[model samples]
Target: MHIHKKLVSLITLSLVLLNTTACSQRIGALNDTLKLAFIGDKDVKLSTQQVNDIPYASIYAQIGDMSQVFIVLVFAEPKVSLTQVPTTLSTELKWLSADKGMIVTVNGRLVRTHNNPTGDLVAVESTEPDPIMLGLQLASTPKTWTRIIDWQPGYHFGYRATSYFNLVGQEKILINDIPTQALHYSETVLVDDLNIQYQNEFWLTPETGNVIKSRQKIAPNLPFIDISLLKPFAS
Candidate 1:
């Protein structure tokens, strides 16, 4: 579809693509799909009952001021869902829109992205396990790690970066208007080569160590993306 038409479709429907066991079949009609009506309204809130009625796993994603609910569309060009990556500690979650815009995350961290208007984060590599995958603990001290990141549209690649993770204590947060307690952690990433530095935050379930919400900036030029799990793909 043309870029302009795709944008119109997205704005009109406000729904992400769909996913099922079979990756080849087209989903139901767009009008029948559940709509994500609140795009850029920060004051918008959803009830737990409203989220529970949705049959598919979903997430609330905000890039800059616009927010939308994206589903796990396995039929996406790259094709993936909540699954373990073989020989790796990271599990991948691929969020794609009707327009084929994709955001690939591992252990709730933005690792790769495609079809982003501000240029995509092509890849992220790390020699050591990410602190997020290790699970942040209350008694844990500050930790640091490094990564090699790549970007596209300008063929920017192999930029070295460092990140520091520090526990900020337990806090109460609301998801879908339901109050819950979570462990909060702060991360600071510094990319000397690109002369860039940014802060990322994560709120995880204290018992399971699963990330419930996060705000991350994968690259210097990219907008800080905020994600909140509305319907968990995991059992």
Candidate 2:
């Protein structure tokens, strides 16, 4: 009974080609099964002296498909020593509207309550969970990948350079231990130079027709620290 309840709590869904990671079946033998990938988190060190590498956390998710959402969380922990004062580790939630207008009731509150000019973020339900899991439900959905059209480059869409806004075929990444191809497109949300961008790597799963992995920089604009796929929250 306890095990069954645990299973009930788990959010079940398929992943699109994906976030910190994606879950998909292989081509032939494993094409019909749903493979789940859970990544863990790493420590982050923030510094004001670095060029663009700002303080950030690694990312991990539990991607899902269909009528799902991309839940993401952030964290930063220091591993050097017990004395290495760690940065305030947490997830800065950036919930988006299903449409392009506004996220009506995010976590229950009106979009205007949490949306601000610079950063008027409001806590929905703050708890230390897996950032990747938060995103998995949405990541599993092929829609998640398609939402970013620039990434559809025949094979796979991802980051292949230092700055995705202008370059490609340079930055490389590993997915499930294999080399994959990627595209680049850095968007400036705020100002031109003061924009946000990332270095990304994507892996597509033909089995599920969704993305499998997405390794991105913490910040696409300012080179902050990076977050890789690790694990997900107890859905």
Instruction: Please provide TM-scores, in order, for all candidate models, with all chains considered together.
Output: 0.77, 0.23
- Model 2 residue 235 distance off true place after TM-score fit, in angstroms: 28
RMSD of 1: 5.2
lDDT tens per residue, model 1, 1-235: 4546645756533333332443324334332333343333333355666566645566777677664545443322332222323344445677766556778776678888887777788877765666777777634633887878888777788888899888898999987677889999999899998788899999999987778899998587778888888777753
User: What would the per-residue lDDT of candidate 2 be over residues 1-235, giving only the tens digit for each residue?
Assistant: 1434322322221111122233333222111211111111222221222211211211223111112222222211222212212432332233221111112121111112122222221212222222222232233322121111111112322322212122223334543234544332222222123233333443333232223344332222222212222122221
Candidate 1 residue spans exceeding 4 A from truth: 1-19, 22-33, 36-46, 73-87, 138-142
TM-score of 2: 0.23
Runs in model 2 lying further than 4 Å from the true structure: 1-6, 11-164, 191-235
Q: Judge candidate 2 against the unseen true structure and give its global Cα lDDT, from 0 to 1.
A: 0.24
Error of 2 at 75 (Å): 29
Give the whole-model CA lDDT for all candidates, comma-separated. 0.68, 0.24
